[model samples]
Target chain A: MNISLILQMAADADPERIGLVCDGERWSYRAIQRAAHGAAANIADIGCSHIALLDESSEAAPIALFGAALAGIPYVPLNYRLADTDLAALLQRIAPAYIVGDVERAKRLAPEGGHTFCSRKDFVAAAEAAADTASGEEREGEGIAAQIFTSGTTAAPKAALLRHSNLLGYILGTVEFCSATEDDAQLVCVPPYHIAGISALLSSFYALRRIVLLPAFDPDDWLQLASAERVTNAFVVPTMLARIIERIDEGVQADLSALRAIAYGGGRMPPELIDRALDLFPETNFTNAYGLTETSSTIALLGPEEHRSAHNSSDPAVRARLGSVGRPLPTVELEIRDEEGKSLPAGECGEVYVRGEQVSGEYRGKSALDAEGWFPTRDAGWLDSEGYLFLAGRADDVIVRGGENISPGEIEEVLMSHPAIAEAVAVGVPSTEWGEAVAIAIVIRPGCDRPDDTTLRTLIKDRLRSSRVPERIAVLDEMPYNEMGKLLRRQVRAHFQDN
Target chain B: MKPGTKLKSAVCDTEVMVIRGSDVEVMCGGALMSEDTPAEKSAIDTAFAEGTLIGKRYVDSDGSVELLCVKPGKGSLSIGGASLQLKEAKPLPSSD
Candidate 1:
């Protein structure tokens, strides 16, 4: 089934329910469906094999998303933040594609040719004009629903192909259709290019929840919009959450009592931030969601109850779970495997592998799944006896100092525990003696005095092995993060190299 | 229909995918379910009105036939001659 079926379910169940809210306007489920149908009819006429969006988060994003699904074409959301040359290069890869949003940038990609481009405003206007037009017929046979470009932190981004069935599997396996009440609204700040953004649209629409889109993230704007709309649900990256927490602490009276749930992912969340957030919003539910662009959003979720229990628990094991990403989804099977792909028992760190209907490890024409359907997620992590999953950062991010591998996530977690430090990143730097030595860069919280190097080193030595302690420390005004809020480790390493 | 076949209600907006297929009739609101389509309102039976919900699995007594409710409806589901009961729902935390 196409992903549009999800929206159709909501439209059929309650047409009058608010489906999307953006820029001081709201569209009912029926209205969104009509717009999507209009867009679908328009897209089908173009005969493009792919539909791409080069814009920020907006109503046009969702319209293009469902419309592409209905047209039996893959919906591709490109990073609007990429440099002109790089953006044009990626756009050329998907030739004969219909490009929507940011007509300026879409036109810049015109040199590639074989592309039809339109701004979000024109897309909306055209779709509305074609509202009465029939949207052809339901897509038959198997088809690709979305083609998302993975955020290339270490290497060039690859297009991850997500089939309609894979997206449907995620929707069917996770969300309960039309389950959200009429009063429920989810605040979406993540850009359309992110998998979380796409999944949020699908799951929220399927559950009949109102979506409030933030074009770009600003702490003040996010808080103001959430309060004004009385948003009950939201999803944020770790960096966003840290900023929100910082804003609240700085005399911003945010009446977030309407917020019932807040899910965070896309990067590791420090335990200290979670603790502060819980103390501030005692009644709100917190969830730590872990997934990848290839995995169709979240495959494991640390629930609200687990957060509270871990926060209040006396048991060390239970308390340590505050750092875990929780157990696998009911539909997913997870295992930790060694280098040889042999499964390892609990507490033994290795590469993470997952198998599920939603696990679309296929990138373009290449299939990353093994014969058994298990996709090897190149992440260094382990599961406890109770099935809680812990992350040791990306496998590639491991700091191999003198042939002993060390996970940056472990060292970062320990450094973040320090009261003065608000953000910390650990990286491996060139060392003449050890091949590579641990290096740390931190952003101290406002008004907190920066701890001396010896003081900070003693903190790590007390908690972790002396070998894990940072050989060099740099306190910066802020750490580097991509627009989506993921740490740019390559950039962080560059900082140490220059110093 | 065989297992893994997705079907829509013939009498309501309910949609489901067969998980444990059987050679017996599978009815939604007393009407046989087929592909996704609008079922006649008159076909909705008041006798089997417990209603189906999305993300919930409904199964027969011996677990030979199972269906997951992909779309909710006022109509109930049944397999063979037995009414399909709601399986215990183990809700995973909303991840995204």
Candidate 2:
């Protein structure tokens, strides 16, 4: 079924319910559906194969999203922050498209060729004007609902296609229809290009929750908006959370009591950061969601109750659960496999493989699913005896020294535990003696003196084996990270080469 | 019936969208359901007056002929004279 059905069902159930809030404007469920229908008509008239949005969060996002689905075309949300050349390359790839949002940037990069462009203001106006127009009969058969470009930190970006079935499967399996009350509002700051952002819109609409959009993430703006709108739910990346915690530490206070739930994903959450956040928002529910762009959204979630239990537990096994991503969703099946494609028992780290209706695993020209339908997530992880899944960064990020596979997360976790270290990254550098030797870079906490190399070495030796100790340690102002908060390990490795 | 097909009861305000379809005839309030608008309302059958709920899914014993209630009313859902059981909700924490 098309994702447009999500909006249609919600609007039909309660047309007068407030659906979206953005920049002090509120829209009802029916209004959003009418605008989507209007946008769909325009897309069909232009005969565009794809609908692309090249701007930050706005009402136009949901309109263009459901509009493309109604028009029976794929919706592609591009990262506006990409370099001009890279943006131009992506634009060319999805040409013969109806591009919405920043028309100026489209004109500059796309050169008014092979695509239709409309400004965010004009698109919303035109959509409202054509609200009465019929969007035509529902398109038959499953079609691509979205074509999201993966944030290629390790490689070039690839357009990952999520079919309508896959997205619907995720929404239906996880969200209860019309479960959110009228007072419920979700503060969305994640960019539209990310899978979490896309799923946030879909699931919120399905659950009939009001959405409050922040065009761009600013901790100050985010906090103020949440208080003004009484925002009850939010999803943030680790970096965003860290900054928010920092802002709170600086005495930037707002009535954040309305925040009932906060979900975080898109990167690893440091144990220290979470501890601070838990203490700060004692009443709010915290969830650690883990999923890739290939999956529709979250496949595994360390939920609120688990968060509180893990934080308060005295048992070592239960306490370690704070670092896990929790068990897979009820609809999903997960396994950890070794290099030979054999499933490994719990407590052994290996590549993560998942199979579920929501698992698309399909790119523009390729299907990544194996014959058995399991998608190799390429995320190195292991499941504990109780089935809690713990991630050790990406499989490719594993450091190999003398045929011994060492997970960088193991060393990074130890370094991050130090009181003086604020951020740490462990990587393998070329070594004539060990073939590849462990190297580390650390960021010292503000106002804290950098610990000597000997002190740090003893800390590692106390917790891990001597081999895990870094042969060389570099103290830097900060570690490089992508916009989504994922550490740029390749850039970190390059640091050793430069020195 | 086919998946994604919307059907309304002629006897009541109930409306449902087919999630899984089979050759079986879907009944609401003891009357056959149709895609077109009902010209007249009929009295509910006392035997099938248990009532349908909004946003709930009903399915046959075998799990086929699944329907999601987009609109709730006094009508009960059934198939081949057997009342379709309410599908139990498997709640998962919202993580989006």
Cα TM-score of candidate 2: 0.95
Candidate 1 segments whose C-alpha is farther than 4 A from its true place: A414-422, A431-435, A442-475, B1-57, B61-76
RMSD of each: 3.1, 2.1
DockQ for the candidates, in order: 0.46, 0.59
Provide the clash count, candidate 1.
Answer: 0
- Candidate maximizing TM-score: 2
In model 1, the clashing pairs are none
Q: Output the number of the DockQ-best candidate.
A: 2
- lDDT string, candidate 1, A1-499, tens digits: 5777787778877899889999999999888888889999998889887889988888898889988888888999999889887788788888888898877767866656679988889998898888786653556434788899887788888899898778888887788766789889999999899999999999999888899999899999999999999999999998899898899889887778799999999987877789888888899999999999899988898899999999999999999998999989998999999879999999998889999989999998699999999999898999999999998878888898999988898788888888899988999999999999999999999999998999889988898888888999998888887877777889989998998
lDDT of 2 by residue, A1-499 (tens): 7888899889988999999998889999999999998888888789888999999999999999998898889999999999998899899998888898888888889985589999999988888888786654556433899999987777789999999889988998899999999999999999999999899999999999999999899999999999999999999999999998899889998899899999999998888789889998999999999998899999999999999999999998999999999999998999999989999999999999999989999999999999999999999999999999999989988888989999998999999888989999999999998899999999999999999999999999899998888999998888898888988898999999999
Per-residue error for A390 in candidate 2, Å, reads 0.8
